[model samples]
Target chain A: MSSCKFINTPALLLDLEIVQRNARLMLDRCQKLGVQLRPHMKTHKTLECADIMTGGSRRCIVVSTLAEASFYADRGYDDILYAYPLPFDKVERCAQLSERLSLFHVLLDNSLALQQLKKRPLSHGKIWHTAGVELTGIYAHCGNTYGCKGEEQIKAVAQQTTAITLQFMEKLKAIGIQGPKSSIGSTPSCSHPVPEMAMLSEVHPGNYVFYDVQQSLIGSCKLEDVAVRVLTRVIGHYPHRNQLLVDCGWTALSLDGGGRLPTGYAIIEGHPELKLTSMTQEHGRVEPISGELDFSQFPLGSVLTFIPHHACATAAMHPVYYVHSKGKIVDTWKPTRGW
Target chain B: MSSCKFINTPALLLDLEIVQRNARLMLDRCQKLGVQLRPHMKTHKTLECADIMTGGSRRCIVVSTLAEASFYADRGYDDILYAYPLPFDKVERCAQLSERLSLFHVLLDNSLALQQLKKRPLSHGKIWHTAGVELTGIYAHCGNTYGCKGEEQIKAVAQQTTAITLQFMEKLKAIGIQGPKSSIGSTPSCSHPVPEMAMLSEVHPGNYVFYDVQQSLIGSCKLEDVAVRVLTRVIGHYPHRNQLLVDCGWTALSLDGGGRLPTGYAIIEGHPELKLTSMTQEHGRVEPISGELDFSQFPLGSVLTFIPHHACATAAMHPVYYVHSKGKIVDTWKPTRGW
Candidate 1:
């Protein structure tokens, strides 16, 4: 049983408690809003986190890729929604999964995509469409909410998205169509749902389970709610350059944020003055945001925790998550990769 | 026997012929220069590429991570040099490899790192240090050459780096030290080596095996020499935004080069007018650089090949590389991941 301190450098450290709390809160939020929470698994595609997000039932999930859908399905988890617009090359795989899973659903996308789905109808009584098209639901990702700065802006975006979604549903009702579910998602909007969101059938928001600095900046979570950190070890001290080289790089921390943060790509957990200025494949250049870097503070082999800017992007870089609680590594979770 | 056309989208497709040509050229260049070519394995960490790179010698390679060192060591590869500065946390693992392999080298780094290596003395007649230190070789990565634009600039930087390395080697000799080797490496510098580079003992260039748009811009190789491309499919067309959505995203292509190229993040192979403007986790937004994006020209599900901006960064995002020749998939190579 290795502890967090003893783990290798450039490892993703998942706080088990923060993850569970984040998971529980989302479940509670959707429960209170009288809507189903079909958590998205794109952020951390590990079975353990999926179980946490789904509250162990492993039911009602959304995946970004068929690889994740198959990974979950192979493990007996069902009721999945392939959330993206239908990809034609993957239609056959989608059909196979649809026939295998209890409720494997894909988006009712453009007419061309509809043809791909119709070419391979479900044989196991899992009917998602009929008469060349089927209206399961309308899905809209409130991705603009990611630009929000605070809770008020987030709620405003959520309210707008929900109202428009409801108006669209009303239009569908006018055309003799009804009972189709509506889903609007983005971690920011879902984390601070508007009151009108209760009218939707389900809410799907990933990244909340592993809230990060981006979610914090978007007002989706407090800084403390971030559950994951890239644990890196200082390898060199360059006093002349006023920089420190750490073991984490784009391969471990990702270049998603574009190093735009005030603290650079990620926020140093305890060092406010330090910024992760840039990275190569396996080396990160850390320097102070203001004054000269005190090289003694970051001795060689000293660990520094990084709260990632985007959890999904950083999580994808790591092959395994070191899940820990109270500084003790409790478990290791492997994630499925590739589509 | 799947072909490139039938394989799944958002895959790394390696051109076997190009790769072989690249390996052969690098080997020939080093042989002509009278220097050992210890190709770095960070670009594509697959054994197949390693075999092609070393000409099946299975020895004298450089890796950025211990996982890579162990991965190669387990497969009977020897003379492994963990090219990174000695990381404190990985010292124990390094020691084990040091005692196990014929030549497992770590950087003779700062005094603190020297102490870490001193803590674990090598046994069984293997020696890296005695009396608190040993000088195996001097290694310098001429990474500054990555910014060079053409052959002249690359040769200039290569000459400068070689001169500085030789000067340092002379300083070591002045201090009564002899029989120490020197190495300076970068794809651009090694691709167009200066005459003085022949004085160095070794050159380790990795990304030359998978040249990319960045390397082409740096003038290391012709764009046609790039051996890998990310195969993506257009999944959606938003004619309103004049954009096409491809299944390739940051997850497949990586957020490297920061969309700095005229073609945004990457150069769409044979589609010079297009730019990969942006990407989410699983979606890439492609739009024309100047004119309207005639949607009919790119039907839904049509494939687009993308030459990555940075091959090492993009390759790190993928789990497997699909090797092909003349449009037929010949083999698949799985690369080791994690630190």
Candidate 2:
């Protein structure tokens, strides 16, 4: 374990203890609801983090990109679901990957996509000859829930998403394909007390593992539950502009705003008066809300921690994360990036 | 390099012919102005692109982060400038890197930063006795020019930036330092003609290689001058909702808006009627401006190219670029990423 003082500024830091706790809480909640939990690997793309989330099962996981799907498949993850609508040009690559995994599934929300999938022969014209490509499940992402105002709004969006998935499933059955499991969820819908439906076979929620300011404002988690932060340094102070520039900028923390929170971009850990007013490519501009900023409180070279507004977006920008446990660096994890 | 047909979706595609043209034009413009061009490599962090930008000189370049400075310095880039206010914690690293190169310079924008550098002994306590960590130059980024409405506004900000830089140089000289160069620039200021100041030694413009919607609106370049585009595919269509979802999202194009253009997130290469309304993590939602979108025109798997609002942010998202020239793949460049 290395000291925090030795770590570089503008680095991603993960609280391993909090991450494991979040994983266990989600797992226990899903278990209590008698539903299968398929952790989305899109948020934290590290196999080590996935191992903890899945309890080393490596059986089921959801990925946002084929690059991620191939990464986990190469490492022997059996059941992988590319959670987004399949890119038609990559159907051949999907077929090749399905041959190695026990099951590989993709999402379809519209009829045009279903028609394209029907025409595309999986496994080089081995249609119906072998289990060339298994349509493991049908899935829908209730992405609109991100814009929902409250629990009622989130539930309404979830219902609409499920109805759309059911209608799409009937179309699949009309084409002589029968009995495909249905999956629909987003972090907000899954985290809330969703009504149990017999049609739902799985729930996939990625960002609950490292809740950010967006999730907190959506009532999924508290501010204290956020497990990841960008550790930065106070570089320059502009008293006239009432701004203090930090090393962390849009490049490190991303440009995602605080979902429903009144906070501008991100919240400084322990300094509630500070507001991240704006950011440039490589400079974060922070200003005080009311009183004058005491520059002496945060001298040059002092480390300041910032919880991101969106964990997934922020995590995608970083290549490595410094994992800390019990106030010390315990491990390091490298995430697979790019398509 | 691979064929365009075989290249992956959401890939960074760089037209080498256009890039070289942009490079040549900027170089010629700087040459005509009789100002040295220390091209900022923060836009394209690749040795191949750097080679062309410097005209194979590999003598001087500007980087936004120390990691970039190290990446280029390790590969034989001698005169490298870490073109941000130096973080006090990294003074030792800057000093160590300076020892290996003919010149390694750091930027200072405030008196406090200068004082810290004065107190910090660089390279094994050679402060009082030897020439320790060298200040490459005084630099001021006219970042406010990005918000300027016209030539008059941009000129005012440029003058203010020059004034601040000159003021900082006097502070350096007062501390027994002398003869350090001064630089001040942004794409808007560098692209336009400014009053010749003897104090200014060089101009650093990063985004001229890939003029984007922002640059075009800023009157720096035309839309035809954009060199990089995100090659994506139409994956789904929703006629009832009037949305055509593509594979490129915020992760690929970023969330930067056009600086002064009326366009939304990004501009479709050949489809001006279509507007990228919003983006999810892996899906871009496009809508028509007035009439219904011709879904038949863009069938499933049809590739669509998009010019991003900010090229630097978009380019940073991709790991490799498919370089094209003369209607064929010419080479591939892998960009260095991370802190």
Candidate 3:
């Protein structure tokens, strides 16, 4: 690795053959849309890319943080799902990580968080049930982008995710608890879903794993299914202000003005009407509208891919993934967690 | 430790007593503003906070990544700077980290990067020097929003940094070169600088610690000298859309927009006339014009504080820095480099 081991030239160089062919084309499109794929380890938070997107099946996973459901439920990954919105001081570490995990999901959109998980204090099996307790399902969002949509906002978010999963199963059966089994999804209102009033058995959908530019302006996946990008390199060229600077900035692409869509930045495969208008902290001005492209022999550094409106917000600003092939770099995929 | 042994909770918690009181308050304000503190370990890229900001003074540092100047010149800290903007595929790791650092500096605003660092091949030993680089003077706009300012863009950036330091000292005395010394700084034109341009004896700001809301909308530090904030916690409550859902997202308060102000989402402390207005990853919508402050008793968990308009773009989106005090969480400050 010493073709120069400074290994941090504006860092982030993941190329495990295009992230294992973008994880086997999104795991064969969630095994041909049978659904229940789970993903969304906040997009590559890496447990070796979540064991290559869980082919070693701990199967079901989707956390946003309880430190990634206690790091894949302490690495054995017993079906997790913490997709954000449960806070009453982390309901006893989500009921002691649903008693050491066979399952421990959670999510909510308030009823005062089901009256603060119906007033805490019930994980008693000593140290929160020796580590295998349960309480699953209660998550909901299905209404992003300043949410709330038609059909009385998707039947009021499926009647508030079926009243916060029946108040988390009546406060886990008035304190008897036992988890795993309910959930929700949201690549912008579950890619056009509406009319299911929560009785969720499962549905996690992580931006289908690329579909960005604000999931194609909230129609969810369709600018040719995004799949992450931002290769970049064209070092500088300004011509007074026709601008060109690319070397990817905002720490390798992420000033996320939350996908304004088709406007400031987004070229994915280059010059398809160039955008990325301006950016600092390392430059990325771009702009070509319908002209300028000689770019002084373009190769000051070359490489220029871009196109991530949000592959999990640009693979959470990279920490390894090069995995190319058709273009070459070979292997390397690492992404455990980056605070 | 079992506080669920730490998992990606939107990271960045380095409060080792406010990072050693923000590194002894910027090395006692560059030893009372005489300037020459050197510090810019790309905003804490850890080697024990670069041995407490280089006290074991091999002094001078700036590195915005060459894997952090070869991890502090392979742990010796021999004066670095690489403040970014040198392309041509990083002139062979800037001529091999200026041949294993003794003083490695870098930063150029273009003259085809001093005609490609005077046709590359930089060195150090056997008296063969040549690679001490610098040149960032008149790139103004640390506040007019997106830089570049008056006095004819600072006397055409001081005549393009004195004709690229006399064409990089006549291509390092026609390639028989020698190294060390050459600098620049740009804390909004080095705080009223302009008088001595070339051989710029060292200076590199790194958001003078934390003066944001885009450096108080460009006049550089004012909002009580802003020093790294973003505590956030508010959970949820829409009270007919008065808004408040915060957990600080876009992955813990980043997505650096509003460099010229008015891009909204965070700035509410001492209520500078409160108004987060909108954000999402978790949520933050504050908007308290005037006060009656009860905000539903800020329930669901409370913490709130923000300052990022660019503290090295929110400290390169966190990895560690919880260094607080009086409010608690007294120690922990690591951030050498990540991605």
Error of 1 at B237 (Å): 1.2
What is the DockQ ranking, best to worst? Answer: 1, 2, 3
Q: How far is B189's C-alpha from truth in model 3 (Å)?
A: 34
TM-score of each: 0.98, 0.92, 0.33
What are the candidates' C-alpha RMSDs?
1.6, 3.4, 20.8
Q: Where does candidate 2 stray beyond 4 Å? A: A109-135, A150-178, A258-261, B1-5, B110-136, B150-156, B159-178, B195-199, B258-261
Single out the weakest 10-residue window by summed lDDT for candidate 1 chain A: A124-133
Tens-digit lDDT track of model 2 for A1-339: 247667888889999988999899988877877778888999989989988888789888989998899889888787888877778777777777766676777666666666656676666434311121445566667878888766787778877777787888789889888766777778888777366433577888889888888887777778889999999899998889877889988889888873223446788888888888877778888788788999888887788888899999999899889999877988999999887
Tens digits of per-residue lDDT for model 1, B63-174: 9999899999999999988888888888789888988998887885588888777777777877663223568789999899987899999999999999999999899889
Candidate 3 lDDT, tens digit per residue, B67-107?
77887787777757666667667777767877766556566
lDDT of 1 at A275: 94
Ranking by TM-score: 1, 2, 3
Instruction: Give the worst 10-residue stretch by lDDT in candidate 1 chain B.
Output: B125-134
- Candidate 2: residue B252 Cα off by (Å): 0.5
lDDT (Cα, tens digit) per residue for candidate 3, span A109-208: 6667766665654544422211132234445555443254343454455456646665776776688765545556665545444444334555565655
In order, what lDDT does every prediction score? 0.90, 0.79, 0.58
Off by over 4 Å in 3: A1-63, A66-183, A194-219, A224-250, A254-270, A273-293, A296-311, A315-339, B1-40, B46-48, B51-53, B65-82, B86-106, B112-171, B175-330, B334-339
